[model samples]
Target: MAESNIHTLVHKETITLFPVDYRISRHAIFLINRNNIDSPLPLLSEIMRSKGFKVTTDQEKADYIMRITSYVTMPTNKNDQALPYSAEFLLSMREKLPVIKPLLVQSGDSPGEQMKATAKLVHNSNQGILGSDASNIISLGSTFGGGAGGLIAGAAASVIDTTASIFSRNSIREGLAGFEFSMTKNSGFLNQVSGLNVYAASATPEKPEALLDAAIGRAAAEMERD
Candidate 1:
């Protein structure tokens, strides 16, 4: 089939996709560089092994070389205590997709890019969940009166609701949330390819493991499905 670049947004789901007609079985030797605490190579390695790929430590001897390009893009200052600019970073990512996208169209089998493999991960966290108070405002306005003032108040409340929802509903849920993974590959020669998938879920700071488990579980499911 023609080269493909796919982006999927899933809630509480980790998506794993192979080439259009390919399954997760050709991974004979696989390796991903573990560079940080947030790195998930071990989790993925387990899944890959289950699908028949042998994990290798010697990169020069392996056929699949996985590189993680994951990073935290917000709250550069650990003490900033404010919400990191996730929305801004996402906007920037959207802009850069055109340049970064071409690299992800290739599959692990051919990796048309003829380049090595790399995956980009973007993560961010905030104090806690942010919820909209517009509905509460509407309720208060309605309870107060019923004449022109009520009509005017209702209209104003509706507008407020819409605006507030826009900011509160941008998918940046509270407490340790991560959003996307853009996988790019180079053939180490000429052509290149990549695949992108967006995953959504958040866990409380005190329950970080919950998020990790959720991701691993979703990944396994996606691997099986695709």
Candidate 2:
């Protein structure tokens, strides 16, 4: 098959949390919790610190406040029978952040599977959100900071390549749906921000958390490039 013909089945979306020009320092505090999943605050703190971000307890010294929460949403769709339950993972970053990313992982067929899938989906979603946040800070800086037009062009090309890769893997795309990712090019970060939503089917293996860890590791490795 041609390289262009290959795709990964994984679905993803990213909202512009900080405007492309939003000023963000290298300090943050995680005030994250969840009604469904275990506390990810410690894990997030460690991850941020490993990326050279100063994890502060003081809100005054933090550049951003990261909040993550997960919950089950009752059925709003008529045909969502096999996956009636919506396991949602929401990530917010700002002074009074709102849900910038609302990732949905559908439940399984039976009630038992649905509950298990919901937990997996929530965990994985949290993982992906944190990992993406780390990498995005650098990517946004390169595109929005003080770079040439080529910088943005390169970023756009990268986005296209990523989408191609995801769609190439049939397995990754399998059992996944309602996936959406986008950002505003001209929005200022000082006032309003954008959100991304990643929706997937069956909250099973290779959960979104795995995807997140991989992305975050890559991004953390590149922090020194800044």
Give the best candidate by lDDT.
2
Best by TM-score: 1
Question: Each model's C-alpha lDDT?
Answer: 0.29, 0.31
In terms of lDDT, the poorest run of 10 residues in model 1 is 131-140
- Candidate 2 yields a Cα-based lDDT of 0.31
lDDT by residue (tens digit), candidate 2, 1-226: 0222111122223434544432224434434332223444555455446656455665565554444331222121112211111122211121221111122243345423433344343333322455333111111112211211122222565444532332232111122222122223232364443333333222333333333333333333333332
Q: Kindly list the per-residue Cα lDDT of model 1 for residues 28-74, writing each as its tens digit.
A: 33443322323235544553465454556555655444432211122
Q: Model 1: residues >4 Å from true position, as ranges?
A: 1-18, 28-54, 69-174, 177-188, 202-206
Looking at model 2, residue 25 earns an lDDT score of: 40
Candidate 2, residue 105: lDDT: 40
Any idea how many clashes model 1 has? 21
